[model samples]
Target chain A: MALLIAVAADDSLREQNVGQSLQERVPGAATVDIHGLYRAHWRYLVRLAVLLVDDTPSAEDVVQDAFIALHRRSGSLRDPDAALAYLRASVVNLSRSVLRRRQVARKHLKVAEPQTVAPADDSVLVRDEHRATLVAVRALPRHQREVLVLRYWSGLSEREIAQTLGISNGAVKSAASRGIATLHRVLGGAPDA
Target chain B: MRDGMGPDDIERQLRDSFDARARAGVPDGAMPPPPRFATAGAAPRRHGRWLAPLAAAAVVLAVVGTVLGLQSGSGHHGQQPVAGPSGRQTSPPVLQTSATAAPVDIRMVPVDGATYGVGMPVVAYFSQRFSSAKPLVAATSVTVSGKPVHAAWYFEKSAKPGYPVEGHLRMRDYWPAHVDVHVTVAANAITPATTVNFHTGARTIAVVEDAKHQMVVTSDDKSLGVFPVSLGTDSTPTGRGTKVIMAKQPSICLSGPGFHGCGIKYAQQLTFSGEYLIAAPWNAALGLRDTSNGCTNLTSADAEYLYRHLRVGDVVKYPDTTGPMMQVAGGLGDWNVPWAVWLKGGLIPTG
Candidate 1:
């Protein structure tokens, strides 16, 4: 408990003058790269969002909103490294709101459980074991999918994941434990304990 | 590394199939039409589902000063209806017992006037285990800001003998901020009878987004401030979890890796493994890069401000980062253990 850490923070400021270069970055993300990165990562993000939101159009909307939020928040970012993460987190949050909106919309419409997402003809669907797995993954609760997808897709650490999902680390661990358990069973890889 | 237990194969397929399907669905240049320019000001989200840590105990040893053996155990077992705090909230009730009256003192971790965060637990320390916790358990009661809470007792497993057996207690959820916790333990027999009190300060929680190098502090659904920080480096990564402030020090010496220095100011300890939030004016890349041994490195000015404003038991959460997960027993990590599991107690059994 007594092993004191020798590391310090202001040391970097003295040795390397990185702040001046950071100023150049603040204005850049606000204009050029917001559009550039949005266009570049749009397809990838839409695809990822679709897995959780369960459709392409809604997923696209979620990504767009996320990009716009990122643009607004980018000024505070000193390092460009945080840009993608901020985008990923925004998407996750926006996806939750979309899900909540759908639940309300469904209740208002008195329609089916809002499952008209998968395209039918030449449906972006491929029939195979992976499809079955994907179906099961999608069918799982949205929060669980958020945990699994963020963990598996974006490769975020549990800490970053909690920030992204606005949940606790313990909740993250619990969701992962339960999600992984269900996936093992769904894929016929493991039986009940 | 996935802490505790996280399987690899299932996670790999989740990625593999996701990547394949995404590529198959969207061919070259098939991006959706650019979104409308309006609606950029995203509505602020109200985090009603904000899950916080268990109550942080700031008065672990203060009870020892007033620990007095109340009386011999009548052996009612585990369910002891404690005598309510007599003369509730008039003048501080002065117990009529000597500190050394009992062989083993029943100490409440309720520091008389210290304030902690919402997640602070109401803890009791037994110098030695009674035949059962009943004698001590029944003699204890807790009220938060004058409202009675049916707080139950969960005994803890000491790391070793002579380390004081603990009876941990908390409400169903994290405590609300700006409340006072009055814990009265009348250990009539096992050891001493003492009533100690502690305050729950603001429900302050700091979430450190590692990638962003931003530490955001919030209290009661309001944003307090955002400070730039440089977290631990790859070699000595900062472990992640919902951690509580265990202590504060004005100045301390810290040495890790290639550096060794003293006069480091405004140190607030997070974990027992030497993780801290401290002043590190030496790092040029305060928010640009990870540089410290494992502590959260902040500017000296920020550190001093936080040291003064933040109290022991205030929560600081680190989402999954490059580091490992924190262990429940590592420091004031009781909050990391799920509530249901926490209810089951540790070492000592309820059933």
Candidate 2:
């Protein structure tokens, strides 16, 4: 019991020091050190947004908006400890908006015929195959795609995924299974284990 | 089954096919996750009838492409997202000219500004009209030594049609120290073609210790005053290091993500560092929050001063504050108090 307490105390001290050190480097940054905070997590945020938006540029925009929001609300972040949580929430919210925008655009924006097309050849065949897979993935319901991206690409633990997305563990698993099943149907039976 | 494939076999094939498609730049719609799949709901796409066969074909072709190992040497060339003239905000990559046109009288107007956070606008005003409706400029396909760059255009609707058109460029994050932007506008068009030389100056000339931590300025030089400002919490540290000043905007809309701001055409920003060109709000409730995406949260006035004076290539650095030993090295890293002292004293010691 003593050892456990000692270890816990040490970890707590380390964390406190990290916070303090950050605060010292960027005084008053305990809560509002958006720069340092972004350095650590922006890549992950961008990566996450990329999956959500499925477009690098749009994902970047989404993440940028999230950071801007953090800056705007820096004062209101009551617990310095929960800054990451706030950021995650903000990013998810922003991504949702992007999705909404895309849906809206799709509904109204009547695009013309594709101006460019791949030339016919073996490469074209491969391109078509890739295009097919993309279409299939896009076909999956938004929830399924989200579940798959978080679980597989983002490599989040089920629990973490649950917390970030605000869902039960059971829901995450079910979503994953269903998504996988649909993907399976699309790919013409599993090729490997 | 068409080929007597089992469910497990099908699932694996699908996953592989999907992943393969992603690698091909086919826009597999896959993103890195910590997914909000639940709250956001499952993949909301309504697959049309034609999707299945196309996907199957895609899988077959991808497998063949893999085996042939003929990596298409050609990179993915995505079509510009076409937006209409009036309602569309996204700017297609500006057209570039390789051939130099007859030397038309070109006026150089350098406007500098900064942002409070990422994706904020950086606008610039031209005193006179652009000479070209389609002035010839060097290619827009330029990248700084370190980071890739992106540009967005916002026309000054209020400006006279023939006069100088106000232009705004929102630079990305973590840019190299030196970035040169080339833009050319037709003599008659409202938008003007302008060339800018952006430099991310060296970091830290002074240290202002405040309630949170230290703020470092790059040089005693008055031409450009680049300060090192901390962003949000360390766990979510905003992008740091040096970037070059690009365009300048008088005002911008901060309607997206973590923060919001407007009417900020202060502080000339680095070309491509972390995507914060906006200024952070001075709300004490935010804990003197260094909560920007690597943008220095300047008082609007200070931002204005920097905006007017600072040129590009002014380096911005945030020395690691674990200790006080500070040193001015090219790369972004930690600095101690001694280093801070040395910097403050104007001693340029090699890191």
Candidate 3:
């Protein structure tokens, strides 16, 4: 069988190991990817991770790890487009790990972290009224948020989401549906917890 | 997909929101410092935060992600995993069958039919909430005098005492300068048809970039002039959004925690929180610094000029500030809310 690419290759996903290094430690890679793909793919990947991780710095860290993983494995990887896919999958998985541990820690330690009160700078991008929806999205159970963001934000297919999250296609579809339903229920005027 | 509302609208909103956040992620030209991976050979310096979390994350993520088959699924039972577009649950169109219920009534805001600024939003305050906003959205129509525009009704639950919900009419962008706005609501089982017409006087936008401590004013999209100004102090930061000048006064008393002065002139209300743009001769050194209690302080002459030209509903935008984001429900901030999210309706959709 031909090398089965689980997720379809997007231009960003296909953005080959940009320059000599795509690692977070490589400052030179910033200059190489700065013009086009940096804005498009790099920033996009970071933003995707941001929604998943709920902070810009953490999102950056997630993207860095994904890129490092991609750079390390690009030698054996014949197809370059798969690099982006590989990076994307890494981000999703890494973010999931971060959130799960955080959730588990919070539950165990009972750490009342200031979870959803978006910092003033975070509000700079999203307006006050729209903050509620983003907050609502953030409030969803972990897996549900991931599915909705991947499906809607990334426009990933069910197969793509399944492969990325390492879940069944049926699980992706179920999570997407439940996520949307949860969004509607939460946003559709249920002024309560 | 349930008449395109099953998951399409919500999906579109999520896409739009995600894209907006992505675009607004880092300030322009402030890309993340390049990753130090190639040289570091070692894992990027691990903060105890990520290092600790990654351990548990790795162990759990290593499960080949059996799709949560291990945990009992009864926790979220009542909210039976709803099938999105990918699954079986189609959103049944909300059916309204009560014939005896009173027809929903809507009235146009600024019923006096006066001229307003380009930033003005056409509001139709409804008497009560309706199960479906379909009728209200369909009944309401806005016709611009000069340019052909595609304006839509964004319905949201209004928090006013009497009116429970409202459908605000706005183009994806601002109205053209010196154009008439004619809003016609067709009387239906839901709302009585009524027409109200108002005019947009000028295209004025005041952008306050806090770093510069100056406001660049524009008329009809052309730079009118740059005026030195003083904005909110550290404690009282001004709202940061494209907010409309909701109301204006020639002179007004200024009062706050420790400051009290009457006859503070050229006051324009920016937010319901009492943030204003006013003439402050008291600030001996205006425009050179940030020291107002949240009001944008301009020289009396400049404030007078603004008062003369800028009418109610003109825009005063703070492009960069560490301040609160304005809510349209609180003031004339409908323009600031992204059109996509606005289309999702509001924080609280119409009941």
Tell me how each candidate scores on DockQ against the true complex: 0.05, 0.04, 0.05
User: Per-residue lDDT of A32-139 in model 3, one digit per residue for the tens?
Assistant: 332122223565687788778776655666776766666656566554345557778888888887677667767776555554332344435453334666778888
Question: By the lDDT metric, which is better: model 1 or model 2?
Answer: 1
Question: Which candidate number maximizes DockQ?
Answer: 3
User: Model 1, residue B40: displacement in angstroms?
Assistant: 76
Lowest lDDT 10-mer window, candidate 2 chain B?
B56-65
TM for every model, in the order presented, reads 0.46, 0.33, 0.46
Candidate 3 shows a clash count of 11
Residue B117 displacement (Å), model 1:
2.2
Off by over 4 Å in 3: A1-193, B1-100, B106-113, B146-148, B347-351
C-alpha-based local distance difference test score of model 2: 0.37
TM-score of chain A of each: 0.69, 0.65, 0.69
Error of 3 at B96 (Å): 5.6
What tens-digit string does per-residue lDDT give for candidate 1 at B1-351? 322213555665666656544533432213233232221232212111110111223444222221112233221222211112111121222222232334353333324676677766654444344445545556777888898887766666432112234555777677778888877766554445678677787878999989999799988878878999999888678998888776566776654433446789888878755678999988888889898888999998889888877877788999956787875555566677776776665545443
Number of the predicted model whose lDDT against the real structure is largest: 1
Clashes of each: 40, 124, 11
User: Which stretch of 10 consecutive residues in model 3 chain B shows the poorest summed lDDT?
Assistant: B56-65
For all predictions, the C-alpha RMSD in Å is 25.5, 22.7, 25.9
